[model samples]
Target: MEQSLYPVEFLHFGIHLKFELTETGIFLKICVVNFSVLGLFFHRPLALNLKAQPGENVTLSCQAPDGVDIEWSRTDLEELQYVFLYRDGHIDSDYQHQSFKNRVELKDKEMKNGNLSVILKNVKEEDSGTYECRFKAAGEGRRKRAFIKTKPISTIQLEVADPDPGELSGCRLNLNSLTGFYFMLEADPEQTLCVD
Candidate 1:
């Protein structure tokens, strides 16, 4: 014969619950608690932030106190694609974008700390945009958008030249970097590289 035992009594500071069992081994119980006390135990969940730099890797992480569902997507597209998703401390699907299929990876697949971080490798200039990370708890949901930009680069050039010594030795002087104009120490303003 099979038997099942369950709680049968629920009691509060001022109230009480009772439990009973039958010959078949079936048991039941009741629970009672102060409304204020239950409310005090309830708490708001924490959210995760995502960030990245261009030509570098970016991770959009979503964390929940109780392993809530997490979804990632881009906002500009008419049809949203699921970059990745997590729930109950596990990856839900293998679905991913073609451009990101091989380059994308998940850091905390175990969801040990409710962390769902999606890492994108070798970010490109086109990837400089916004990303969305959403979390769903029961029937409630919240979302966050992160903007990514490209890293800074330095560009420089150098050149050497030799002009006619006869043209450079006279009183006339030339400054070629900013423009093709020239100036003379003893010449009038009109004679100094004037258009007329």
Candidate 2:
């Protein structure tokens, strides 16, 4: 009599295994290789830069899907500061920082259209920093209940510049000039002279 062997392949949970079957019985060869791991995915965050003058209102835009729990935080600070937090179809102000209190607002009506942006009123020099927008999909569970895992969707770098005095006088000053120029003239004692 003659004996023959056949090769068999099996794949389970991203792991590949091979086996050999003969006329007498079955033989097991443990060959395990993983191509992908469960729950290990990559997500690239979007970058946004914004510049505004002092006392100006700025809106930090974060485009995410509708009905997701969104949170805005200042990551450039010494400690992670919560700017705004929206969850369960409402804004949670208890976790917001004192500096951002009563100054942040969300476009509640626009959330239906996937606009998770927040408006920061009266931007100050202190507000210039890197802000991160994170989102947590509904029904998503983390490995630990104490550790709330969220995914970063967007990052915004804000810059606030002082208002130019010449701009208030309806004069367009060339700010690119490296050399400062001065003008002197004989005027009344009550007159004042200002140099930018």
Candidate 3:
């Protein structure tokens, strides 16, 4: 299935993802030079705004290619912000912040298919801040062994609010990541309202 070069995927986060169909396998080649396209064309804020009530569980989403080391933390909590760290195929608890000692965990411990999202349990008002996920990408081209620390690959502004009387029970949040789209289906025993 050798196909001609063409733009076959959605343009996400200013990065142009070109997927080529070849006999060997479908290859994804990302052009970082076009990072400017995001601001130049969309004129939109990069951080995704999300809201959750205190005591509710929320997931801060992130995605990157496999083989990359990922770090999840609260950008606002500078004093003790290291939320979760995964490297060398295991969680590194040595550097994790005490506040997040037992409150945060990876959605998928295996991280299969590059799902780097973290589930923050028991949300608090103090946790209302910018949650960022960064990845250490392998150096491109000839310097494959070298590591490139990218700018905050994904930033999530989590607003912990207090639910009013008769407030809704569940909410669905959808956002695109550096490498793919992430969506969570909240518990809806009666009916699930699709987020369009």
Query: In candidate 2, which residue pairs clash?
Result: none
> What TM-score does candidate 1 reach?
0.40
Q: Pick the candidate with the highest lDDT.
A: 2
Q: Judged by lDDT relative to the true structure, which candidate is superior, 2 or 3? A: 2
Can you write out model 1's per-residue Cα lDDT over 57-110, one digit (the tens) per residue?
A: 666544443335566555443343555555444554555455665666676656
Q: Provide the lDDT at 148 for model 3.
A: 25
The TM-score of predicted model 2 comes to 0.56
Task: Determine which window of 10 residues in candidate 1 has minimal summed lDDT.
Answer: 150-159
lDDT of 1: 0.45
Per-prediction TM-score to the true structure, in the order listed: 0.40, 0.56, 0.56
Q: Could you report the Cα RMSD, in angstroms, for every candidate shown? A: 20.6, 15.6, 16.5
TM-score pick, better of 1 and 2:
2
Residue 5, candidate 1: C-alpha displacement in angstroms: 37
Candidate 2 residue-wise lDDT at 69: 69
Give the 10-residue window scoring lowest on summed lDDT in candidate 3. 36-45
Model 3 Cα displacement at 31 (Å)? 34
